[model samples]
Target: MSSMLSLRNVWVEYGEKVVLERVDLDIAERSFVSIVGPSGAGKSTLLRLLLGQEVPTRGRILLDGVPLKPECGPDRGVVFQRYSIFPHLDARHNVLFGLECAAAPFTGRLFGRARRIALDEADAMLAAVGLGDSGHVFPAHMSGGMQQRLSIAQALVKRPRILLLDEPFGALDPGIRADMHVLVTRLWREQALTIAMVTHDISEAFTLATRVLTLDKRRHDPHAPHRYGATAVYDLTLDRRVAAETAHTASITIDDNVNN
Candidate 1:
């Protein structure tokens, strides 16, 4: 395992309003980290910066020590709350689309053995996310959780070095949310994925993260950079890992089937 992501002194601002300030973090070879904060606290902003969708107003981000580029790549996957799948395309085709785009950007197609491998890869990804038999179904036929699962598989089909997820489970029911948490954690561990997600759920933060980061849009300290604001990083391996994956470890003791 090797280091996958690093951010140093990153600052993001929109016009006169700065959203994030001097944020530095390192997500190691195999880790799941979450950034949790109040709304308008620039949690999504941080993920955008990492994905190279938004350039830092001040500092820079490095993926595996390479300066963050200004575009997305196969090595950097993102599974957002909104599934990017085309409603017309079936599940396998949707995942295949990402693989085809990434692994074959120019020709953008696979033939002979390559075609078979690509389809197989797409099927495997779908299976990993518990959509094993849904390859032929369209997005319209799926539930919110299923669509989100499809989104994750599409993003991971390219085997991204870093997984950037923005509130991936927000739309699911509580039961589904818990199950998705376990699904993602197991994926991260088994695949050695380096993930950084933005979430408001503090218990979710503790459950899924190897570390937790908090962003406060309110500038309270004079040294807090007169720009966007201040962010704090917490080493949560202790507090978070102590909570086993058992259902008893969850903060909300609701009996309602969450994923339903």
Candidate 2:
């Protein structure tokens, strides 16, 4: 398999506070991988690096064998943990936002070729995520799962080279999370998308990832506010089904969440 993304000897620092040191990773094409670790382990930070949301202090980040953009582009789509969609915008509009932001002309803007294509793509993606008929509904009125799904659809509509998810199912209940897991799995199979999702829930990582990457603080500090011991990366393609099933047994507690 060809490599879709790579991080080599990467280092991240926040004003002298080092987050990750000498981090290296490679993401293969059409693979669904998850980043798992304790809080402040640089899991989310890894997603940020992949999406080009932040610059690494050292090393390099690449997309399609090239460097990434400064603030992300249509080539990369992101679904944040919190519903990042506009509250007032309905599901269709939310999906359309990504297209509108695209460097391409007329996309998701005025009525024309770009608008038509953007709308059509959004419709297909929404349908794929089980939001076909809910395109007209505002995200505020939709269930948590529906909102999360819309965020994913919006991310997928643009055919991004890599989809970055930050704890997408973190807010859903156990049953709903399971259902959404299936939905994501089907979509991944259909589109052959390259995904890198950050999740604290080990079960979600196991059930959804082609690989599991455990991030850790590369450097040791006795007084560090948060210290991650060591990064542990695992390959799951050899036994994804087993990993998923075994992961389900350790579903994170979601008593207050809703079921599918």
Candidate 3:
């Protein structure tokens, strides 16, 4: 597959402190990539770069061979560790918020036919995230897993080319995290999404990611601790045969149901 995103010799600095350094990476289309490292390893910084929330001090971050803008756009979506859903809006309305914001930035409200279409899309997205029956419920009323699912739904309602996750399942329990792993993998295949997730869990990184990238500062000096920043110390691609088969089987089931 062609490269969907690339970071060429990227570096980031916060005043006198450096966060990332000499980062060169490329992500292929529709690939699930997970980033793992110790604390303050610049994993979340990398996601922020991809999200266009921060600009690199040096080098380039490219999407489809074009330099990405500093501002966020429709092409990139994100889900953070915290359930980033609206507290005031219900599940369905939260999903609709993305469509609303994209369609009308100043006023996040739709009307008439546009409103109907957005509602329909929101319903489909809620169903896709297994929150169909929870459309009327608020995020506070839902479980952690359910809230995370709703966050995913809200992000995907825009059909972004890339999804950036920052410790998406960090707060969930083991069982719920496992369920989220399956849900994310299924969604990646079904939606043909290119994903970049940052997590501290080694197992979760290995389980959900086709490619794993480790970021940490390579050089350490007792006298000068903050001289250097984190780099991509390890990049490994796993065998995704099992994931492929699972997605294929699910696709077949859907097709059979549609045909029947």
Candidate 4:
């Protein structure tokens, strides 16, 4: 598989504090990558880098072999743990916002034929995320899962090639999180997206991703904790079948332990 995104010798430093160092990675096209790490290990920072929201203090990032722009581009879309949507707008308008912005930067609104076409696209994307009937609903009226579904639709409506998820399911209940997993998996497959998700859930990381990466510091300074930075210490690629089997076995083991 060809690389869709590449990072070479990437480092993120804020003053004397180093968050990440010597980070080199290649994310293949259509691959689902889950990033896991301890607190302050730079997982979210890594996602920000992928989203073009942050530039590494040292080194570079490349998308499709070209140098990545510092600004967030339309090619990359992001969903956060907190619902990133317009509370005032209905679901349809929230999803239509991106298209409108892209079409008319100055006005941030589409007119007549263009507005109609954008609305149709937004509706289709809402349907794709199982929000077909909720287009007119406000965020305050929706459940957490529904809000997340709307968030996904909003991100996907723009037809971004890469999706960046920052602990997207962290705030949801287990059942809701499971449903989101199914939704995200289906979207990833159907959209042929290259996804980079940051999560604290190990099971989720292992279950949903084609590749799992663990970031940690190779060397730690006890006196000055920020002296060293986290890097990808473990990079494991899994076949879909293998990932399923492993996740299943893990589930059984956890269940048995709980019962015992």
TM of each candidate vs. truth: 0.86, 0.86, 0.92, 0.95
lDDT of 4 by residue, 177-259 (tens): 99999999999999999999998777898899999888888887899998799999878897877786697665455335323
Residue 164 lDDT in candidate 1? 92
Query: Could you tell me which 10 consecutive residues in candidate 1 have the lowest summed lDDT?
Result: 251-260
Between candidates 3 and 4, which one is better according to TM-score? 4
Better of 2 and 4 by lDDT: 4
lDDT: which candidate is best? 4
Candidate 4 has what TM-score? Answer: 0.95
Give the candidates in order of lDDT, highest first. Answer: 4, 3, 1, 2
TM-score of 3: 0.92
lDDT of 2 by residue, 78-171 (tens): 9887988899899998888777777345543656786788788888888889999998999779999999998888888878777888988888
The parts of candidate 1 lying over 4 Å away from their true place are 1-3, 218-228, 233-235, 239-241, 244-260
lDDT of 1 by residue, 72-164 (tens): 766788988877878999999999987787767898787888789999999999999999999999999999889999998988888887899
| lDDT: the better of candidates 1 and 3 | 3
lDDT value, candidate 2, whole model: 0.77
Scored by lDDT, model 1 comes in at 0.79
